[model samples]
Target: MKLLIYCLNYAPELTGIGKYAAEQAEWLAMHGHDVRVITSHPYYPAWRVADDHCGWRYQREQRAGVTVFRAPLWVPHTPSSIKRLLHLASFALCSLPLLAAQWRWRPEVIFLVEPPLACSPAALAFARLRHCKAWLHIQDYEVEAAFALGLLKHPWLELAASALERHALMHFDRISTISSSMLSLARRKAVPDERLVYLPNWADLAIAPSASSVALRSALGIPAHAVAALYSGNMGNKQGLEILAEAARLLAGETGIHFIFCGAGPGRALLEQRCQDLPQVHFLALQPAEQFPALLGAADIHLLPQRADAADLVLPSKLAGMLASGRPVIATAEAGTELASLVSQFGIVTPPGDAQAMVRALQALAERPARRGLFGAAGKAWAASHLDRHAVLARLESELRRLTEGGGAGTRGTTLEGLGEK
Candidate 1:
């Protein structure tokens, strides 16, 4: 099977969709599929193109059996709604020539990653020209999320943009998204059930912790007796991370509990400013991937926060890693939101932006070691069963193979049932 993955982000981005897309492409190649990825240079979580890739308009390289084609993208120093749109547009526009150039080496399938839904038409054109199936795997519902999160608020513009996105969505042969809630949103956009595939995000179960890092608590400056509540991942607007600072402020007198915020993003400065006065808080930069297990293992609890408006539009890809780390999570989500419903069994949920509620949840967990242990164990077990990386990718590969061999359109939504069984 020959597969072409079209995404704005790819390997070395270190977070979010890029990480997963790179993994998927490499895994397919290793499993005997001819995989080719067309993507923009790494610029995520940090939002700046890496130093070495600064001058290149285009670069092609082979990484572990996968053919990678990197296109130039306009990176904004500080991302606003319009600037971010331009950023996606830059990549989409720049990659079109490359997509057209791939006509000779016709791939069996062209899988597109959405965010820059602006590129859908280009991908559809490539698929049409190549006479192959076009698949869309959405990492974020950007159009709706923009309005819902107040990132873009003109009523007329919202209607026009949504109409355009809806039109682009209908042209794809197969549309897969990360969460059931996200799939439901796709359905609400009038995408027929037959077109939707539930391809949930997965966890890296193979990560091994370093034995020497067991003293990570002391290394992070937290005392042995302090209960560390950690928030680690991209600090962005959608994260509603201000609540962490508020919760820390509310619990500042509780010396037994400590708050640690790790990872960098546009929101990092704001988070640091907000929590600067709080002595119980510590902020760390993103650690190396190999140190993930030890870093995650050091935390007594993990914190995940999603804005109320953006909760359903995007599922935090970081949640899967946290669950796999065997640490109890405390997330801010409304009572019946998708995240709350999904995590109810494995972690504690509080209303979004509610500092008092978060403080209470943190206090409750910090005082109850037995309850924390139970939640951690349950999360670990669930991740092993549901978020296994190989199993998820194998299922995806099988579906893609069936789609291509069966002549394009899949078994009319049958993959959803298979996903449910898993």
Candidate 2:
């Protein structure tokens, strides 16, 4: 099968949807399918294009049997709401020619990854031109999320954005997203029940955890007596990371408890400023993929925070890795939200932006190693049973094959509700 994936982010971005999309494309190619990706130059989490990919209008590259077409895009150093719109718009406009050009490839399936939903109309057009099935895999509901998070506040603009998103979603033959709550939102938007599928993000189970990291602990100045609560991923506005800083401040006097914030993004500066006076807090850069397992293993408790408003709209991709690492998580989410419900069995959940609540949760985990161990074991078991990258990607491949083969139920069984269903 020939597969064409259209997404704003792709390989080399190293976090969020890009990493998962790259994994999907490479896995499909390795399994004897012809896969091609149309994406912008690698720029994400940091929101600045890499030096190597700069000054290029267009570029083509191949990696691991997959062909990639990179289109030029504007990257905002500080992505306010308006700048973010412009960023997505630039890519949507720039990638049109590339999308049209793919018609000659006659791909059996044209997969579109959303966040930059601005590219959807063009993706749909290309799929129509090629007489292929259009499958939209939403990594995040950008429009709704922006509105919910108060990033875009004009009433008229909100209506316009909602209309555009609804129109784009309704036209796709198959629509998939990362979480059940997100899919429920799609249903509320009037997406037909049959067309909605449940595809999920997966973790790389192949990377085994390293031996106890004495050298890493020494280099980072982590005392052998201290307990580290690590938050490792992109630092973004929607993360509600301010609460982490507040928690650090509240716990500054607890010498045995440390807070480690590791990642890059626009929000990093705010966190650094808030935590400057605290001695028990540390900041680190994003580690290479090879070092991910050990880096995760270094943490005694994982911190996964999300803004309450953006809770269900964007599921944290980092959560899978945290669970897979055999470490318990402490996340800030509302009681009824997906993150809260999902982590209830294996970790602690607190209300978003409640510094006291977060501090209390952290203190509980710090004091009770036995409770942490039980949660960690359960999380690791769950991840091992359900979050395997190969299994998740293979199931998606099977669904696409069925869709192209004119099988009986085109969208019925594609929902991966089995994952995280408990």
Against the reference, the lDDT scores of all candidates come to 0.84, 0.85
Q: Which pairs clash inside model 2?
A: 198-415
lDDT (10s digit) by residue, model 2, range 1-422: 99999998887878888899898999999999999999999888887888788725799999789999999889889998888888888999999888878867789999999977888888888777778999999999988889888888889988888888987888998898988888888888888867777888898665344664445656788897789899988998789999999899999889999878889999999999999999888888887777777788888899999998897899999999988878889999899888898898888999888999999999999999999999988888887777888777877887798789876343443333365231
lDDT string for model 1 (331-374, tens) is 98877777898777878999998999999989999999999889
Q: Where is model 1 more than 4 Å wrong at Cα?
A: 207-212, 407-422
Judge candidate 2 at residue 189 and give its lDDT: 87
The segments of candidate 2 whose C-alpha lies over 4 angstroms from its true place after superposition are 206-209, 410-417, 420-422
TM-score for each model: 0.95, 0.96
